[model samples]
Target: MPAEKKAYPLRISATVLEAMQRWADDELRSVNAQIEFVLRQALHNNGRLKPAKVKPLTDDDTR
Candidate 1:
């Protein structure tokens, strides 16, 4: 199954935006994907990522 998706609006300084775009390109990801990946990593590192709310009936949801 595909991952669920959501949209968010953000504001940042031009310098930060430029740096993020360059980093995203270097990582071979779109800016949005890179941002999401970084945020997920940070959340996991800080032990802030919540567990899945719904239990899976099978292995499919585990991925």
Candidate 2:
């Protein structure tokens, strides 16, 4: 089964939001989906997003 969707609250300047909306439309993705995709790409590029080899870390390692 697919995972449940999670909601996130984001704050952005009007100009940036408008640009994002336009880009999302051009890519045929919902604004939320576009933002999530962009964020995931960035995380993966920076090695922040990776498969878990062991158990999850606590708050200390996260920082």
Candidate 3:
């Protein structure tokens, strides 16, 4: 599935930003992609991602 993206501004210290740039270079990903990858990884590690809920069919929709 294709992922959705939104543009947002961020503030970070130069030290952290430089470290992230170097990390992104090593991973061959844009700095923004690298940041998203790291965040998703952290969320998965902590079991923060929840499965989507499914809705049951209702009589009204049967038409």
Number of the top TM-score candidate? 3
Model 1 pairs whose backbones collide: none
Worst 10 residues of 1 by lDDT: 50-59
Give the poorly placed runs of model 3, Cα more than 4 Å off. Answer: 50-63
lDDT of 2 at 35: 90
Q: Arrange candidates by TM-score, descending.
A: 3, 1, 2
The C-alpha lDDT values of all candidates are 0.85, 0.86, 0.87
Q: TM per model?
A: 0.71, 0.71, 0.72
Candidate 3 local lDDT, 1-63, one digit each (tens):
445788999998999999999999999999998998888888878999754466779999898
Which is superior by lDDT, 1 or 3?
A: 3
lDDT tens digits by residue: candidate 2, 1-63 = 444788878889999889989999999999888998898889989999984357669999998
Model 1 C-alpha lDDT versus the unseen true structure: 0.85
Task: Output the lDDT of residue 42, model 1.
Answer: 89
Question: Candidate 3, residue 14: CA error in Å?
Answer: 0.5
